[model samples]
Target: MDSLKKKEQTLKSSCTTSQFCFFCTMKEPDSPQRRAGLANCFKQMPLTDDQENVLVSSGLFHIAMAQPDDPEFPSLGIFECMASLIQKGVNDEMWLRRDQNIYIPYYAAHIIGSYTMNKVEFAEKAVESGVIPPLMELLRGNKMSWVEQRVAVRALGHLASYERTFEALSTYEEEVVRLAMDLASTCVDVVYDNFVGVKDTRRRAKYQCDLLTRGVGGFEMENCKAEEWTSQLQCWSLYLLNCFAYKERSLNLICEEGFLRNLCGMWGGLANHVSPAGVGLIRILCYSKYGRKKVAELNEVVESLCNLSRSSDDWQYMGIDCLLLLLKDTDTRYKVIDIAFFFLVDLVEIKDLGDRSNFGEAIIKVLLLDYHKQNKVKLINISSSKARKAVEDLWDWNVERRRKERAMSDEKLEERRVLVGLIKQQASRLYCLGEIEEATRKYSEALALCPLSLRKERMVLYSNRARCRLLLEDPSSAIRDSTRALCLSTPANSHRKSLWRRSQAYDMKGLAKESLMDCIMFIKYGCIKSDQDQTATKPRSGVKIPYYAARMISKQMDATWLFATARSRIKESDNQCGNDEGQYYREEIMMRKMMDNRGLSTIREEPLVVKEDINRRKVERARRISKRATSQIGLPHDVGVAEIQCGGPTKRDRYSKFSSSDFISF
Candidate 1:
């Protein structure tokens, strides 16, 4: 105790001017006896790295918790200290063990983010202090937790929000956007594996759990905390991506066609849902002519947006904005405008869009770009099955008369059904004669004329249309048509031909689970011929799956279980690539590179040997891909999106009042 006091006395004497304010004397061992003859609040003292880090963490904790008006919010030399601790956490695993060091980096980053949230001056201080690189380190670190990541992204976002610090963050542009993309793609799974998935309390990372519980409580709070953090991490990553998208940097990489298809589906768990999620990125991309051109060409992207425009999803208007941007320009208005305009017709009556600028008028203007009005049909209350007629039975005579009319209707329906069958026979002949486009059109013509009551004939036409779509390289439409056929069956999802065609369609879209399940269900409809309508959903015991179904099952199993397999389905003989058994050894490698680097890197710099291996793999990948260069490819959950500037919740586009010149009066 006497020697400890003497040591403190010597440290107090070593205090320097700059270090003085950044540090103050500590109660090293925390005992009242050391209070003897002490200055009570001793002057700042020089300290070693470990000692200084402890002080930094303490200051950061207090500052981060403090409101913005507090005097200590951006204290002297604090930015440099925070930046140093973050770099240490990224560079030195050993330092993380020294005196609450893990918390030091997190707290420091929080303080930086918190202070910079409302002020450009504090953000400028952060940029000048070299906070961006270390923050980027934590953002891109291989082993950092979501806790660290969220703070890093938040700080960078605040810094990126400002005009002065924006250029600093852009130094590592490709790396930053790619890292955020990978994070947005995999954060849910990452949180699930570590915090949510583990059942044993002892196995979970203690520091993370402590941070989640905020050094208190248990699992009950952890679930909610986990959800909140998961959302923040995903949102902030996209927010960072949005910062890039706002500036239009790396559009080629961001605009990768396959990535765009997956982007429309990467909607997150929860967010400042007012602006956008993945669709937010799409909207930003649509603003640019190059982005518009790319977005307009992808059939799947247009179809996905079309579906969203009609659904109850939050980003419905955002989807409309993307299609409008595409339609608003003539150079980019190609195939998708025709496809999307069909869906936007229903949205023409929508109002109260909050500064989206003349919602109804915008949709109408686009619709009238090359408009052609058509006559509409109105059906009477003569009742072709509303199912409402049963409740109002004051009409006993009406029922008997309707039953008598129904017999005549049935006989006429049979005649019409026969005509549909004859047309189907012609389509089948065209299909066999290699006139697939002609066959597809004939099937559509038959479907248009067929009555809704003719379920079986419509099922056949839909199944035939799905096959034609597959050959035409339009898997989205094929999936839609095949799904319709399955729903039309007596027992939903039971038609043998529909199941098989939908499975093939799913395979074409690179959806393994959907394809595999459909194949299993197809096999379950035991012994049914392609032409046979009398199929069962439940498999018969001791019945063998047919040769074709067996072959399909093999390919689907390969798709679901193995990685890096070929996905292109052959038209001539129903052949699928990746039947070669040699590529099966990459099950582990597939997880590592699945979604093509969708997973976050676990380390900062690859070692020489690892880099060499990557080079060799790239060559081999090039070789493999060249052989099947024409096949349709798909991206994983990791392809992504974000908002405009993610300063805070990356606020939605600020809609102007109707009085503004930007607002169109409908």
Candidate 2:
């Protein structure tokens, strides 16, 4: 006891500041006496105007709590030190007047956030220490800096993870909901404003600048710093919304307050950070029946989502989910089916359906549910044998010939051609709907019955058949059919559909030379197929279609070349270019080098040496692109489309109506 007393005296004599005293005192041996001594020391320390000293003391308290089992440590005392920092930071009139020591509350928030992590018991104790009020206060508008606001909301998010803190947060539910809505509205406004007057050269220029530097909101370059702060605030705000979205009360409040409207309005154009969280929130709320109805009632919402699903790959899954849920309602099924069926068919063709192959099942449900809604005669039940028979009869080769025989004149040949056209149309629909085998059979039947006079129609059948064969994994047959269609074409570029399909077939068969040539021709011809129905929908009206088409062709072309080059480099590094494979590969590589092109979504991983070589080539390509872009457009060129900048939740102006009362001061 005498030696311990001497050690304590020596530690106290060496302490130069309250921060040092706080740590030196905590370093004592474990005992009830030590806990009492630490508490008394904290209480005796004068309130230093030095924000760093108080912040450091809070840091020491957090460290002490790291070992909860230490008998000398007291969780309650540590929380008190953190709470004291909060009280001093907020209540200190001089610091508040000068705004000099705001980091005190910021660090206090960090301590509270860290203490609550994976420790539910500490959360309950911290709540009892009046930590919630200060954390909540920091989230209020005009109460703290952007960084501080983000830290506070993040701390609350951690606290809200615990059942106790979540309940405590619910007590202040109205303010929290309002804040979340405000942040959501800001994000929505940013995206919507991006499309406003987009045709105006100035707005388009500003939009581009915003995407690159996030400075378009004020048209000043320095606002880029504000952009980061805004992005962080928006992220955490969505997080807070996700935390609050689980309960029925919060769900109702969110829906009642226009969160759905903002979410739907921005679905077409959300920033990278906000899109995932926004979609997640929509998915969560749509899980409820009332939420589903609210969404279904908003025709514009449905329209935006359908448009988004068609254009953006990022939101397709969630868009499909929300569509499926809305389709469950009998009254809305037909309307949704009309808008969604086309893209859903497209999605079914490319994406792995996994268990959600019920996409087809859902269509079946919609057909059944809306059987009486249409004024026309209801079609045969999709599942019944009669429907199967009708489908078979429609595609049967003999049935069309029999109908033609009844004409008994030269007109009968024309009738045969008409019957062939009908069969081809049905086959095209089946192929798009992902019934590949059946569509192939129908296409063959149509071709067999087609008269020589219907030469154009025959070419289309061959092209359609080629697509089915490609999807069905018969590359050789697909190539043959596509080649046949190309040979019988009406004009130079009129066979683009056949050409592109043949390219895909060549790619599948590892015939990269043939594929690259076809892709180049497709791009040369505006990238749209001759068949009107087969063309991809334009993302926006009045935008040139060829630009996007060229972009896609470029991407696929690069993908093919990368695969070919990497394989050749690995297998035939020193081979002469006289061979069929080597000649084509060498020419294409030369073409790429001259154009200084780089690939997106390359075909396969390369060996380390090949990978390094490709990377060096890519860097050189990018440099060339940058220089060319500057010369031509005067703006930095991004290969991908630039996203719009949405202000994050921390934008001060959005929540400026709320005063300091909204934040916790105690």
Candidate 3:
């Protein structure tokens, strides 16, 4: 200590006594002469270790603190000198014996790393000058101290930032990526082995931290267990992996080796910094289907994504981007929906409309695919607002999608209108000409070109097509088309027309019951009391009286056929004596309609109670008649009548429609 102090004191005095010393050269006045002097002094040939040691001990590292471009500073030759010292210090055997010697290169690498940050050309020069090999050596473990590793990692990160240095680092990309995967895989294995009882993630994370930070020994050991320290190393490794993610070869190797699962595992223990890089890497990898399948297979990957999505706003979108890709797979989509539903709900609630729109699609897909219709109702019942909004937004989005697909500008809309009008006219002309096939084709063409929202035109088109279909003897298709027309038509006249056409279709389909129902509905809504009434109320536009009369008579004949068929079917069922409730109800309805149409009262003459009483009296009368006939060996019919006549004075007899109370009379 005393010898070094005396040497430093003497060195200061010598520097003060002479203006031609290294210190004076370093801090020379601003002039062309001084610039040349400083440059010449700094321009020394390849430095030896002995000279570097002497200069470092004499405070040579301070000179490197200023950048090379400082007005009075020396040339960039200082970087060469510092880089040489770093290279020698890491490579020398004796240099590791003293703690102070390690820092000489550590600080030098810092300066070099910082200086090369903004200068790609300079970084390339440094790479060519071989600064990467020494920095890489520090990163590789030959039992370097944490402090040494820290600076080394940082320096490498800075160098790797530039394209040129990044390329230089690519030589070691395989080793670095594998190293990270091994650490992460080790962490996953540890957790998996103890996974049964390790339910608390934070506790598990602490255990990982302890295992890493404290090692198996203790913190005081040379290579203390610093999970945080290891995490720093992994961050740089992941940085390299992130760059490699864009390269197809490296990415496939990373995935094929099962490195991505370990990457996902890092989320629980090292999320704050590692997650963003890991997520970005996975996002890039998922651009291909196989990579997405691999990522989706990893355990707790969805959980990690949910954690990231909940961590911050920026991660939320990035996480969802990855999720959308993963969701393309069926199993992964269900898992994501199952585990992350509430988190996604929260995201949708807080995000702006744009993000919510995407979230809506995801939610709808999950609900549509994973849940059955019954389960969907239950899910909605649980979170009505979220489910409802999701459905509504999805519908609105679908509508907008269709709208955009049509690209319906004003010009296009006008052209479609003109085309639709001409097509419909041509179809109508063909229909009147009895060319049913040609008319059907023209109507279908018009429908294909028509806008989806034009309900009235679509209804007319569907109705016209159904007429053509009916002419073609395709009753099923005609029924479908007419039913659609009825659903779309709002006006009473259109409803009546649609109902009549549909009834005709059902009759042609041999569905007497359905035809009857349509006829009833048509009368119910159209209020057509009779064929004469329908004609009187019908709109008389462009119709000759003969055509109107013929049309009305045709509709009246169809109505008569439908009613007679329904009534005969009901009567046949009633006579079968099979207790058919449907037929009984149909009969009662028909009776009511018949009475109402004839302007007659709907009330029945015999009260229900009186009818029951009359039935009992008739049974008693039959029994008495049998007894009278059996009592007298050959009793005359007149004698049985006399007994009934004697009993006819009873009050029940006057209530009966017939004077006699026998079963036949009643």
TM-score of each: 0.51, 0.48, 0.42
Write candidate 2's Cα lDDT for 87-198 as tens digits: 6666675774442244456556766666676678777877887777777676774545445566677667777777777898888888887776676556323422332212
Superposed model 1: Cα runs more than 4 Å off? 1-59, 69-72, 271-275, 355-358, 372-666
Residue 37 lDDT, candidate 1, scale 0-100? 12
Tell me the spans in candidate 2 whose CA falls farther than 4 Å from its real position: 1-15, 23-51, 54-76, 97-100, 187-229, 250-252, 256-258, 265-275, 311-315, 331-335, 350-666
lDDT of each: 0.58, 0.52, 0.50
Residue-level lDDT of model 1, residues 520-550, one tens digit each, is 5564453333213333564422233333344
Best prediction by TM-score: 1
* Best-fitting candidate, scored by lDDT: 1
On TM-score, who's better, 2 or 3? 2
Report how far residue 152 has shifted in candidate 1, in Å.
0.8
lDDT of 2 at 128: 81
lDDT tens digits by residue: candidate 3, 301-342: 666665444332234467667766665565455434545554
Candidate 1 residue-wise lDDT at 271: 23
Cα-lDDT of candidate 3: 0.50
Backbone clash count for every predicted candidate, in the order shown: 1, 4, 6
